[model samples]
Target: MLYQEKHRPQLHFTPKENWINDPNGLVYYEGEYHLFYQRNPHSNDHADMHWGHATSTDLYHWEEHGIALAPDELGTIFSGSAVVDKNNTSGLFESASGGLVAIFTHDGESQQQSIAYSEDKGRTWIKYEGNPVIPNTKIKDFRDPKVSWHEDSKKWVMALACGDHIQFYNSPNLIDWTYLSSFGKEYPSHIGVWECPDLLYLPVEGSSKKEWVLIVSINADGPNGGSAVYYFTGSFDGKVFHPNEKPEDALKWADAGKDFYAAVSWDNTEDTYWIGWMSNWQYAGVMPVSPWRSAMSLARKISLYEKDGNLLLKQTPVIADNRKEAASYQDVTIQPDTAESYAISDTAQIDLRISEASSSTKWGVKFVTDQEEVFQLAIDTQENTYTFYRTEGMIDFSEEFPEEIKGTLNGLDVQNLTAIVDRSSVELFLNNGLTVSTNLIYPQGTVTQLEVFAVNDVLQIDNVSWTQLKSIWN
Candidate 1:
């Protein structure tokens, strides 16, 4: 079983075959979650883009519904969003049953926005005859339209990524867009062209006032490297947005990890949730894909919290990984360059807290075999950084592969951390989601042991928690 399909993720969302990227059109209606993705049907490589559909009553087990939308005269279907038009906004509803609308990008001679609707659940789809609803003005990079209904404005708002910045469009109905404003001009990091854009309102963690969050995904030059999602918090008064952060700290990463990208929230009336593509495009095309290429990250509930006067995103996985606590440590003191081993599964979650985290402290946790380490997580009190690396045990090791990814917290005073491990992925929630590191790791063989060690000085590790996770397929 390991030789045939060792890297195939049993937990993440992978198709039966071929290529997949960017979780598109996430919506919740009638007690079911609808997920549309960007896929290529012909081969393992990316090409003829189409919208692949899937449905899940609970976020864990999914049922693929084949292609939802295909290439038309307008062009191939690209990344976009889905929403339930409760009041028949577009008037495309044949009756009360026909109100689910999907807004997506049509990539042809140029890029433009289009709409499609399904009256009977999401089994069937019909494209709007009036496509290219928001025509492109020859912008070199114009795509990925994320639309949401604004209650305060009493209209629909669209957040479209346009080159270096994002454009805001408003419409009374789902059609007939009126340009409002543009953002992201030298205010934040612009290492690559912004692709997916998501704008939503989140209430401050403890306060009553809610703030708007703008999320942008870039291909390269992430803080930790490769593809990542960066977000900005500000005020959106129906038309324009005002940045609430200091100029130097305007943009913040959604996750400090290298894999999480193209993340967008699910449209819900009660709770806010999001999902992301769990592989980096840097080496996506070359992964050892037999029947399938990539998968989506675990669905996570998105919430806002305020600490030290900054609004931070707290992500909690929808599906718990706790099969049982296999091993644990409490108030263990480690000497310099000393290591300790614990029993763990290939898929697991580890929670740790430090009693004293200071400049002279350096610690690392390794997933290894008899000979070498397969994966490693490091924390440096001196540098004030957290690092995750998949340098060894990779099936197809390449110099082209991304290097160790790193993220930072103020004063590097991280006391608590949660690490979720899967067959080919790892998600690190540092300081309770203040910092996140999600990485893809294809080990050469099964991981055999877990070792925790300290360097430079004696470190006190306390409040340790361990869980041998169950398979999501089960």
Candidate 2:
């Protein structure tokens, strides 16, 4: 079969070939950004796990660097983290802080965390002979070690997903670990076992206070089902993570979408940044994109915000909003129950501002080809919710993809909407960073036009502009 290059993502990070799942061992070294992932290099199916490698100078354009950590006598490589060993803490290299270190999980008889050091940046790695740094316990599910430096305690802290709650462990030399505490046993969304947990400390805006953000990804149990990313804002006292006080059963989600999962931050970055596997565990390898299976969401700059006395994490695209406008229209008024269509790029960024919205107004946008309607993003004022419906448009390789994904927000306050469309994904952000919806869909046919329409009531569009994005693979 001929490869459908049009279905390949242009701006997102995808492996040169084969299957990849979780984003692993992300770190910033000097000027280059390193992204290691859970990969199967031999085929487009999930097996023979290895840490596939890629490097980017600016985190926008990536260079595939083959595999970094392969399977050994212990087992195949799994999800973990990487760090720059400053001050020669691990004593793996002669130099002080320039040495690179990668901490990962080896899956054998049981899941165990191990350490590997690189003398020449992150290109080469040597596993610590004293392997299984954090030996396996009696638990069944234990993996994904996300490590960071805790200055107050003067030790390295690891946030790992065990079963339900993420456990905290303190390490002195990245080898020996002391179990501190575990969180999230019977609280919040315990629909499934947690995976890919990241603990982050964020400074509050214009305040002396700081809060710790823990990102947890769940599968089979999300707001939209299949897979999703959820988060909590609190303070970690180097021993235990104390989630901020909230009403009973109030759980916060990172991105209210089905696609984004196993997200983590970049180590040694001056500012907080993140990226996620743009796939759901439900249909990850089944999408059949051929040479490659999945891609990563665009890197996002993360910040903290206050809403209803709760500190929430807001994500905005790290890449600048610079693109060539293919077509644009401003303050276009839509008559009652009418539709409008315009030409657009296969990959584009769309901005929409709809004002004079009423309780009866039903406004939405659709991605379509001349022969088929690919996807639809519709807002229902009466329900005070936004829905992304793909039942009529998607090519379902499996029985996992959801027919519709809906998110509820203050629809009255929703005046601005930005949609970032790649060949196979759509990430929708509303009113700055209040709510985001990331969905993956494979249009059965070509997608070459954009359409906006209204139902039941007349609506006036304050502004509408779209720009075709350049391919990062170029």
TM-score of each: 0.94, 0.94
List ranges where model 1 is wrong by over 4 Å.
Answer: 1-4, 246-250, 321-325, 356-360, 395-398
Per-residue C-alpha lDDT of model 2 across residues 48-139, encoded as one tens digit per residue: 99999898887778888878999999899999999887877888887765478899999888999999998876887999999999889977
* Residue-wise C-alpha lDDT for candidate 1, range 65-169, written one tens digit per residue: 889999989899999999998888788986754468899999999999999998877778999998879998889899999999989999999999998899999
Model 1: how far residue 33 lies from native, Å: 1.4
- Cα RMSD, model 1: 2.3
Model 2 collision count: 0
* Range of the 10 consecutive residues with the lowest summed lDDT in candidate 1: 393-402
Show the colliding residue pairs in model 1. Answer: 98-119
Range of the 10 consecutive residues with the lowest summed lDDT in candidate 2? 354-363
Among these predicted structures, which one has the highest TM-score? 2
Please list the residue runs of candidate 2 whose C-alpha ends up more than 4 Å from where it truly belongs after superposition.
1-4, 204-209, 245-247, 320-322, 356-361, 410-412
